[model samples]
Target chain A: MSILKKLPSKARLEQVKKLSSEIFGSTWNPNNIRNGSKILRAPLKGPELVNYYGVNDSMPTFQDFKKWFPELKLVDPREAYRVKMVEDRKKRNKGAPKKKKE
Target chain B: MPFRFPVKFDIPKHAYVNARVLRDQFKRIQYADNEVTRNALRYLARNTELPAKVRLEAQLQLTSMPKYTSYSQIKNRCVATGHARSVISDFKLNRTAFRERARAGLIPGVTKASW
Candidate 1:
């Protein structure tokens, strides 16, 4: 069974959202709200989340998530943010021109 | 009886496709370069299945020195020999050579020790 399937639901989401707001220094938007809810409903395995979310291998743990959302069982946003940043950088590089051939 | 009107969001199909493509390509490139920026490009390339030439071009253009190297070392290497571009080209041709050269500090502004 998928790890995400085993996670807590509704109540957990509320807690996580509250935490996300504090850590991100911004209010949660629809997209992240949906994502955060999904994460709470079924917390994906680290690697699976990385693959699906385009996160890095070095992402944070459930404990870190707890620190952020003390109430919900989740992974740390800091780790998630790190992976997201890596993914973002790759996208930025795609349009750049190749180096001049010697 | 109910009359239904379809609602369309402003987000374009190209934007979604582009983002997906970008992420996949970044994933592929990440294995090669392993930096956040490089990895993201790899993810995009892999997802889009961009032509190999285009992907290679992106890799070449975006490649940079590892963080540990000093600016002076990079400048000196450039003046001493036009090896930076060559090393990157070599990396494209032969993966093993790329690794070796990267280890030997042949690529300007990067060192295996740092990696």
Candidate 2:
């Protein structure tokens, strides 16, 4: 007979496994079933993926400048021309209908 | 131009917009918005320890979400021209645009190879 004692019982092995798993902060999955932990382990790609389009850094138009700094009293020449054309059209009675005063 | 509706910031006038680009933008937005919930449900559905009914319910919910919410649907498109094919992700420009810009000295550090 060997000097060493017999192998530990199945229940005792199970207890040891459970305790070790608990101590090590690991999942006690003796059945080796699917836990879907892989999915959680993968980093979330949402924030980076959404920002892939990048920020809009287009040159600010005159209208935008006015919106940002109203005190500057900036006037866009194109807008002035458009308003003048609209006035001309209104004088000729070709403008859009006025909204009803409720 | 990729967005049909107004966003927080103004979209540049030169940004190309088309039906495909519009759809891709929608998918990207949806994916970003629902990614967390989708992953959670996926985890639940795949977990064998969970009750069968709960797992089934999670799967059903996952299926009910829009197909656009999936990341695989997003296709990289040219930011300048909205072309779907041969897009170089580094500059987000298609081959033609990339070649034109590179030759015009628009893209930095890219010179014509004529040795």
Candidate 3:
């Protein structure tokens, strides 16, 4: 074997690289710099994250039900309790002070 | 259900919602809503050939978006009771809820382990 084996020329090497990339259908990035293509190729996590909690039944609350059927005159237990407490407090003269008419 | 968040997000809410659970729900919605735009901005910010001024602008815009829009802000909490610790992701329940449901045979294929 020869002491100094001749290496391929720079132009020949470049040609070979271009041909290989073309054959393999790969990007010909000569400078080998960041292109950020990976970001575009990445799968979106939004749909999966949004669906993590499953479907919302969208159950209507007491207020919503009452709004939909105003004629029903639904009495919420908590509201009733609050009204009773306020009434008892007023009877004992411990209720909120009346707003003075300006 | 209580309309707790500052802006009402159209997302599912559990019956036992509290401040923490509401925060998580907010993060989830923010992330899902901005994911595509965020990705596009990230690509623009990272592309080396892009003008430095444009890249910096993209970076600034990305940072200006709410921190809640990042996936890292999301945390998995117990869906049943809003418990933070020892949650089983598959069931979305904390250990306490998981044990109770398992014992009650409410969870399919879950049985008491006996040696």
Question: What are the per-model DockQ values?
Answer: 0.02, 0.37, 0.41
- Residue B81, model 1: lDDT of 23
The residue-level lDDT of candidate 3 at A98 comes to 97
Query: B1-115 in candidate 1: lDDT tens per residue?
Result: 2322122112212212243333332332333333444444444344334666776666564455343221122211111222324434323323445576678878677665543
lDDT of 1: 0.43
- For candidate 1, the chain B TM-score comes to 0.21
Residue-level error in angstroms, candidate 1, position A102: 34
Query: Model 1, DockQ value?
Result: 0.02
Q: Model 1: how many Å of interface RMSD?
A: 19.1
Q: Which lDDT tens digits does candidate 2 get at residues A1-102?
A: 988599989999999999999999888878888999888878988877665556445455566689999998989888899999999999999998998887
Task: Tell me the lDDT of candidate 2.
Answer: 0.82
Which candidate should be chosen as best, given lDDT against the real structure?
A: 3
- Superior candidate under DockQ, 2 versus 3: 3
Output the better candidate (1/2) by lDDT.
Answer: 2
TM-score of every candidate:
0.16, 0.62, 0.63
Runs of candidate 2 with Cα error greater than 4 angstroms are A1-33, A57-63, A69-102, B1-14
Q: lDDT tens string, model 1, A1-102?
A: 676867689778878987988897755553432222321333222333113223333565455557878667676578799888877877988444667888
Model 3 / residue B63 / CA error / Å: 0.6
Which stretch of 10 consecutive residues in model 3 chain A shows the poorest summed lDDT? Answer: A50-59
Tens digits of per-residue lDDT for model 3, A1-102: 977589889999999999999999887889888989889888988877765555465566677779999999999999999999999999999999998887
